[model samples]
Target: MAAVPALPVSLSGRFKGSFAYFTIKDRLPQILTRVIDTLHRHKNEFFEEHGEKGVEAEKRAISFLSKLRNELQTDKPVTPLEDELPDAALWNQYLDYQRNLPNGNGEPSWFQSPWLYVECYMYRRIHAALAQNPPIDNFDVFKEGKAQNFFESQEAVIALCTYFQELLKNIKDLDEKQLQEELFKLLQVSLWGNKCDLSFSAGEDSSQKSSPLQSLENMVPYILVNDMEKVWSLLVNAKKNRTERSNVRVDIILDNAGFELVSDLVLADFLLSSKLADEVYFHGKSIPWYVSDTTKHDFNWTIKQLGSANHMWMSRCGINWEGNLKKGVWVFHDHMFWTLPHDFSSMSEVASDLYAELQKSNLLLFKGDLNYRKLTGDRKWEYSVPFHQALNKFHPAPLCSLRTLKSDTQVGLKPGQGEQIQASESEWMGELIFILRHLIELQ
Candidate 1:
């Protein structure tokens, strides 16, 4: 295994009055409560489907989750996962690693350990609770919330689809400059779409209701870091040097399941439509994650919803996307590595296969704040620390992070910029200020 970097400390809930503490004390419990309620509300359905067996499974899963929630709330020692999932051994090994840390207490609890590790461990434990029982093994507790997010964002979805269709209609006639401008606009749209994250709201409704394209110009100033132009140039240059036009590949590591997903899909479609990328690969969580992260089911569900919509341009875009999937222009991948607690720097040693797959991409577009947190190891880094430095040794390909600042751990800012923002907007980091970063410093 790769040694942990000797850097700033990990963000932990042990520090009171911090965002990590708030997430552990308030948001996590709120999400757990909702999951429990959802299971309880489905008792009759379980009975109807699997009779007593299903009902028993539901009850057992709920009981396990309730206990897990209590452990988190009471700051009990983090226990080993008892279920026999494929990754159970790996998870326990990680726990051992935590116990062996230099600041070891022998028992890493919810509030005292790395916030990222504990937060991710909570979701993984939830999966194990359900999977331990037979009938409910494949159940997704967060499915209803994800569908609701998509349904609630229908208006914005239509608006975004309409704009994309218009762009496609004129894409062939546009000059190079116009293409770059359109790419920048879509990047901005994707960046801001990250605001609709259910986890940040503790499972509350947070769907986009306004037209995303219309807000780009107004929201430009809030973007603390904008590297869209550098991203565009890299794509253009790669295309110029390649003998085969169909060789360029772009990978999007997706985030939420609602409108943010729609935004990512549209961006992927545009990349193919404009010939900037010949193939776009999407990476999603293997399990339902963080209340809102995408899974294979969510990805297909969104496309199916779009294809079945009554609107003209929306349905056309959906049909086109469905066709793109059929033609292998767009691909979806779900790896267990994505759902694990490891940071990006450990991917080579821990998930060598996934890391090798990422290395084949010409450009990697990591979406949303969770991905940002993972990329930076969720550490307490200075604002002026360079983005590459924060990443430690993980650089599989030329990458860009399109994220909104919904967490306190941020890097790659000017000396005075972070201070200025902190003085003016006290809650700015958690309020979803747009941020974009390019990892071409190592290029």
Candidate 2:
């Protein structure tokens, strides 16, 4: 197994005034409060369904969550997960690993541990709280927020679907140059769609309000790294080199649910319609995650909502997506490996099956900030570090990350570019970046 990179220290809340600190100190507690409020607000609904047991379950869950919030605010030590789910033992083992790290800070706590590990641990604990409460074990505390995001982004969804449908009508008539341009446009639409992240805004309403297609040109300057040309070249060359019996598979590790999901779907549709890829695989979370990350439920719900919509173009697009899934032209997968707190570097050792599966793809597209952080190990790397090095020998295939910076860690930039932006803009981290890196030879 490859060693974890000894680069810089992992990004943690220990750095005062940093984004990690702000997230732990302010954003996280706000999210916890919202979860507690949601449980309390739904007490009457629980009573209607499961009667006394449901109401009792709801009360107990709320009490657990309230106590969880207090622990975080008080900087209490991170505790072991008690739920007997398949991943629970692993979670407890990870806690023990954190506690015994060389040069450790005694026991891992909310504000003193690695931001990625502790943040993930908090969500797992939230699940455990409800999981132990029986009648409510299956309930999703984040469901309401995810559904609201989908409903609120209706206008943007309609606009994107309409534009995509029109583009498909004449796709075959376009020249290679025109095809490349269209690919670039769709990729950017998917990239900027990341702005709808609810976690970034602390469970607030972060849906898209305007036309996503119209805003692409305006957002171009915000991309610190643009690798569209290389991505296009790689796809085109793969097509040229393929035999009639061979297939080019593209895997998209998805991100936020609402407008962002629609954007990713549109890009996948374009890939199939343009013959750039024969099949597209979408990977989502098995559990509710990061406030807005897509899960299997959210994926099917969005498709169903789109298919049953009143608008013609939107409904047609949804029906087409449904057909793609049925025909195996599109596939959706949720691996437990995604929800675990380990970095990609640990995948070969901890989740070898998933790592092997990714090795089959011709191209991998990882969407949003959290995926980017995982790709780069959520560490403090120098600005000009090469993209492949930041990956820490975790390459399974040629991959691209369509991420909008919403965190403190970023890599694969020019010498002074990251510093230049940081000095001038307090919110510079909230911009888009398109990165392509190939650490291993293509299969």
* Best of the candidates, TM-score: 1
Candidate 2 local distance difference test against the native = 0.88
Give model 1 RMSD, 1 decimal.
Answer: 2.0
Where is model 2 more than 4 Å wrong at Cα? Answer: 1-5, 431-443
TM-score for each candidate, following the candidate numbering: 0.98, 0.96
Candidate 2 residue-wise lDDT at 226: 86
Which residue pairs in model 2 clash with each other?
Answer: none
Tens digit of per-residue lDDT, candidate 2, span 1-443: 98774678889889998889899999999999999888889989889988999999998888888898899889899988877899988888889999999967889998889999989988888888788987878898888888898899999999999999999889999999999999999998998888899988989999898887887787787777888888898899888988998898899999999999999999999999999999999999999899999999999999999999999999999999999999999999999989999988899988999899888788899998899899888988898898888888888989999888888788878899888877888577654433333333454
TM-score of candidate 1 on Cα atoms, chains taken together: 0.98
Question: Which digits, one per residue and each the tens of the lDDT, describe model 1 over residues 109-175?
Answer: 9999999999999999888878888787888999999999999999999999998998888999999
